[model samples]
Target chain A: MTVQLDFLKNVLYFSGLDLAEIESIDKLVFEKSAERGEMVLLEGESATDLYFVASGAVKVFKTSAEGKEQILSIVRPGESFNDVSIFDGGPNPASARAMGPVLLYGIKKNDIEAILRNHPRVVLNVINVLASRVRHLVSLVEDLSFKHVIGRVAKILFEQVGGGQMGRGPRLTQQEMAAMAGTAREVVGRSLKALEEEGAIKVDRNRIVITDKEALKRVMEVSS
Target chain B: MAEMPGIDREKCDGCGLCVIVCHCGALTMVDKSINIIETVECDWCTDCEAVCATGAISCPFEISIE
Candidate 1:
């Protein structure tokens, strides 16, 4: 088994495939690299390839007409992005950019179609990934419509703290948090301060802790 | 609570991403744990706290926005 196969084995869309199918994909995939903050795919560009992150992170985001940016997801290594365009034979729904220096493996759309024709498992996996993304979007819409900035901010922080675990969770940048909460960074900063005032969280130089999980959850429960 | 962000030695999980982002020389990882030197005052940029997932580093100051 080649290293590429091993990496493909772990991707969300490529998971559950046997070694043989993975070997074939290795032939069709091409390697690409991008510097930090470089554009990987642009919105409205006709779909040409399905990209998988081989290393580093990709930010999938949409821009408002007024030029405000809302990030949808951070596509990490062993994850795929821009599959919507590849699947539907349409332009990209969102633009993607490298969060840092990144390595990517992209399979052209025609080859992806060929693989789908050969492997039914790949088709099912794609369906599952799309379904999961839709469910996440639905939740985001509900939060945007019904939840205030404080609630959204508290919810992200509480979820990231890993519920009393000693030290487990990824580094989430404030900008990323703002994007996830569908608000501006200033709003999130204010929300954090408010959460601390409520005794739900503490942010000292020596320690940033979720002091009261219950309080945090209650704040999350509050609607806009 | 020090004026700038401080590291909770007990709560810190030793993910050095915070240390990497800290522009000030205030934070260091000593043996897989965050060590905040008392000598250097943090600039209070809050970048360290922004990257922390474990809530190990806190970057809060009193702000009145009434």
Candidate 2:
């Protein structure tokens, strides 16, 4: 019980709450575990609860009629999702899938609403986070629309490296890269090949190594 | 044909930013106006809509999937 309260207090949305408030929230939340590739929430489903990642990761994405997927964002531990649906009283805007074995704390909408009503400051925090999300979505739109495949791939690489720097990032598959870039897998493959030819990035069996970050940035800057 | 995004010509300043942002090459600029050249490739991600500073482009027929 104390452990759960501690976890609740660490969540950004609940961080403003005092220990007593955190304890109260802990009572209203329940833990849910999902294996990798499990669908935690489906797009268009009624938003009944808000979820906070307790452990592992979740991928929020949209799929087309032809099964093409565009990843919106990846929610890491301590992050929350479905807040928009909960507040707007609308269905989920996107689907959430477990990227790995995941643990989440599900807070019923009614319970959360009650807490928010009592603590208006928490609402401010929520707004701040939502605003950042808007910025990210706008940047993603810019990347997809204005940037070429190689540029998009380079941008993703730089982002994964925590900005344009030579570093090892997560081991992402070609399909994952395609989804992040909002393009097809073949396009991502071709772009990576081009980058490799330019001596900008080194591709291994599972991961990519940034050989020259400046070159990658130059690739992104060259207008198509 | 896939549902394509609508551009409000009246509001559009013909900045051509939307043309540059479309990854699928669905948008083109003809006579300083944005046009949807290929609707099939358009995933309707609304990248053009998001970047439209004048709020000119919108996806009227596009469902709110995300």
What is candidate 1's lDDT per residue for A37-125, written digit by digit as tens?
A: 68998888887988997876677888778675666776766778888888888899999987556789999989999999998888899
True contacts kept of 1: 0.00
Q: List DockQ, one per candidate, in order.
A: 0.09, 0.01
TM-score to native of every candidate shown = 0.62, 0.55
DockQ score of candidate 1? 0.09
Best by DockQ: 1
Top model number, lDDT = 2
Q: Model 2 Cα displacement at A38 (Å)?
A: 0.5
- Fnat for model 2 comes to 0.00
In order, what are the TM-scores of chain A for the candidates?
Answer: 0.69, 0.69
lDDT of 1 at A55: 73
Highest TM-score scorer: 1
